[model samples]
Target: MEPEAKWNGSSDQVEFSRMSPRSQGFTKLPGQKTCGKSVLLFTFVLLISAALWGTLLFLFITRYQEIVQDLGKLRESCVYHNDSGILTVIGQLQETQLNLKTNVPQLSKTLNKLQEDQTTLKSKASQFSQQLNRFEEDGTAFRSQVLNEKNTATQAREKLQEEIQKLWIEFQRANGSICTKCPENWQVFQKKCYFFGKEPKTWAQAKYACINLQGRLVSIKSREEQVFLNRNANKKGSWIGLRDLDIEGIFLWMDGSSLNYTNWGRGEPNNQGQGEDCVAMRGTSGLWNDANCRGQQDSWICEKLATC
Candidate 1:
């Protein structure tokens, strides 16, 4: 058996070496530095966060400044508007004051002139009223005077008419008949005076008869003659010296004088022609009318130059 082959698998001889403590630990080959990778990743994320925060802060500050500038501008505009309004009001007040100052004197002058005109008009009106009052007083007095004069004249005229009427009545009454009331020495021939014995005849015949005796029919001239003849003559209608000529209504006396006085009965002398050719007295009334020349035998009236 060869001595059991030396069985220790030893290739080299063992030697004991001594080492330092720092170098004694087994060290893994340098690990890939995974901790450094984790740190880098964290730092990158922190930097991005800081940049985003700074940008947001800057945007907030700019917006705040813009808001403050707009507020200041608005306040300034309000102040400016208030000042403009005050100035406008003050200017208007000044213009009004100036206009009043310009017009006041002119208005005062016009008012004074109006007062003067009113005074003049009042004076004229007062004068006119006084004149009118005087005229009225004068007119009233004149009317009274005229009325008094008219009354006096009317009374005088009425009295004269009454006297004339009384005279006419007295003459008529005395001439109505022949009586002892007649004149003395008068002989009654048919109630009229005659020369003792005178023949009674017609108007034409007696006219001729009287002519032969140098006398004519009685001519009545005055109121005394009428009264005397009326009292003494026969009172059937008697002839008068008055007669109408052949010309229709032309009456005249035998003396060829137109009769200015005529005493005729109402509507008498209608000239009933045929045989009525003479003018006669209608009785003692002294009224006359046309009648027949020989109407009737009443009396004869003769006229002669007065013997006594």
Candidate 2:
């Protein structure tokens, strides 16, 4: 300061010193030894750093609010989609339930119908079984009846064969020499010709019947002849040639021969009040009886010479 003052306080220097601090701020300061350049530089840098940090904090706060808003929107969207998904699942469940409801009754009805059909089949099978059993029993009975009938027929055939054999033998013995054959429905015995009447007739009618056929009433002359006549006659009595019409208590034959053979029953030939005068032989016993000439008798026997 002394050095500059020695230069005789020049007018310009004095004026510069009297200028304001604001105008000469970098130039000088009161009681400041020298200018603090490095301190100023450090202060400027700190201010710049504070301003940059304030800008970055403002940007971060603003972006954080925007991000929170975006998150809220996303949460709403997720909730809506979840609700829709749940509704869809519920709808599907309801559809499935409806389908089951519709089909269950139909299936149940089908099952019941099948069961009924099975029961009906069982009943039909039972009925068929019973019918089969009845048929079997009927078949057994029919077979037994047939067997019995067959046995009876066999026995009857054997008896018929025996009778035929006897008849053939008798035929041979009776007609060996004459070689004669009897008429249809007629039986042969010994060598005599006989006609046995099945219908009833009066004694006189019987006599006439025999005469019409070139024969006469049978004259039983011997015991063998009586037996022969009895064997051929039917169940009832038959007219003979013997009669007492010419005289009471005296019998004569139709051929004008006297009655030589007699086989009267135990209580016969009484010649009751009606005046029985005709003669008939009992078919069963071959005994004699005196009956009325006009009375009806079961049969009559006619005799003729064998057809020689």
Candidate 3:
């Protein structure tokens, strides 16, 4: 048993209590009554608390690591989605650029076509203007030609009128009415045409000239025919269609008909020692006379049927 230490007068002396503080199976110490069983129980309780704290800390650290891994996976998913969006935008831009390249050349070609069409229109307008000028020149030339033709026709009409006036004056001085519209330089009788010669010819030549006019030499069928022919002789002896070539002193007409008419002059048909075989009419007395067939210095007269 152990005595309890008194505090007041116990500097050197200790007081003892009636109850001892020591328990069973304890190592008693100075004045404390600590038992071995109590000490061992306290130590066991401290060990269990330390073990629980360490287990709680380990569980928190494991949960934090799991959260960090989930965050990393989310970041990777967002990056992939953003990259796909950017690629889609870039592809759209490239398509737009290609469309611009294709359309721009077509627009340029259309503009060029418009310019060409404008130039062609201008060229055609110039050609049309040139053609119009040519047409005007041709019209002027045609009008000039028509005016010249009109002037020529007027001059011809005036000359024809003067000729008609001269012919009317001559007809007033004749013995009978004149025929109209005879050929130029030919005298018109009742139904015959007479051509007067300016030059002299032989009796045979005179007969041939009448033949060339579609007739024979003049033959007197009546006194009126003889008088009509003598007026045209103009004071010159003219040949008649009378000859004695077949028989001397038995005269035959040049037309081979019977000698049905005669108008012998005063010293007629003596043959004149020159073989006078052709007959002629004297213009002064208008009487028939035999002449040499080859005699020159005699005017010729041609007779033909009148065409009108």
Candidate 4:
């Protein structure tokens, strides 16, 4: 509150005033109001641009990371899928091997059975071959034996036939005087030949009478002689070929020859309790029978001593 001072309107004072904000020139500066507005606008624009750029860079990095992560996950998934596929392939292989193992024993058993069957067939074939060989051998032996037997039989038959022919010829040559019966005065000389037409007598008496005359009763050596004697002997009875003087009462011939010829009638020479020392000729039946000796007889033949 000082009292009124003196006023001096000088140039310095005017300049100073003008420099102050209260000066008119300060107020009239070009675009001063719009400068603050322009600064604010520029700041806002820079901030907005920086934020947009940062956002864009962040978005690009995030998108790039996401793509990279997705690629990695895809690779991992591919690896896992490949490993799983390999494992599956391995599992299939193992199962195949297991199946093969399971069938091996059965296959071996089948092979063994086949081998056994082959062996059995071979054995059967061998047996059949042996049987065939044996059959052939037996057939050969049998043929040889049959041939030998046939030859032997033929030789024997030929020999036997020759002997039979010789015997028949000898029989024919000897049959003339030896097989004939003679008359009363006549006498057969050989093979028990005899004469008839004398008186009948007991066989024993006839045999004694012949013996006293140095002859024997008629003794036969052949069927022809027996037939001749049977035809010539008298009807009552006469001496014949047989006598019982040897051991065990067996009949023998007076000529010391074997009694090989016999023509006994049925039931004849069945010696009774009485002695049967001589043989008698049966006239009707033309056979011989046993009888007692020491009976009478008529004419008889005396056997002469052999001259040769």
User: What is candidate 1's lDDT per residue for 138-200, written digit by digit as tens?
Assistant: 988988788867745754664465456445545655887223232344343322343211345
Which sequence of candidate numbers ranks them by TM-score, best first? Answer: 2, 3, 4, 1
Candidate 3 lDDT trough over 10 residues, lowest sum: 16-25
- What pairs collide in candidate 3? none
Decreasing lDDT order of the candidates: 2, 3, 4, 1
How high is the lDDT of residue 164 in model 4? Answer: 67
Model 2 weakest 10-residue run by lDDT: 1-10
Estimate, for each residue in 129-200, the C-alpha lDDT of model 3 and write its tens digit.
999999989989989788868755754664465456555645653646543445677777765567766567
TM for every model, in the order presented, reads: 0.34, 0.41, 0.39, 0.35
Task: Give lDDT for model 2.
Answer: 0.79
How high a TM-score does candidate 2 get? 0.41
Candidate 4's displacement at residue 78, Å, is: 99
How many clashes does the backbone of model 4 have?
Answer: 2
lDDT of each: 0.64, 0.79, 0.74, 0.65
Clashes of 3: 0
Please give, for residues 88-149, the per-residue lDDT of candidate 4 as tens digits: 99999999999989999998999999999999999999999999999999999999799878
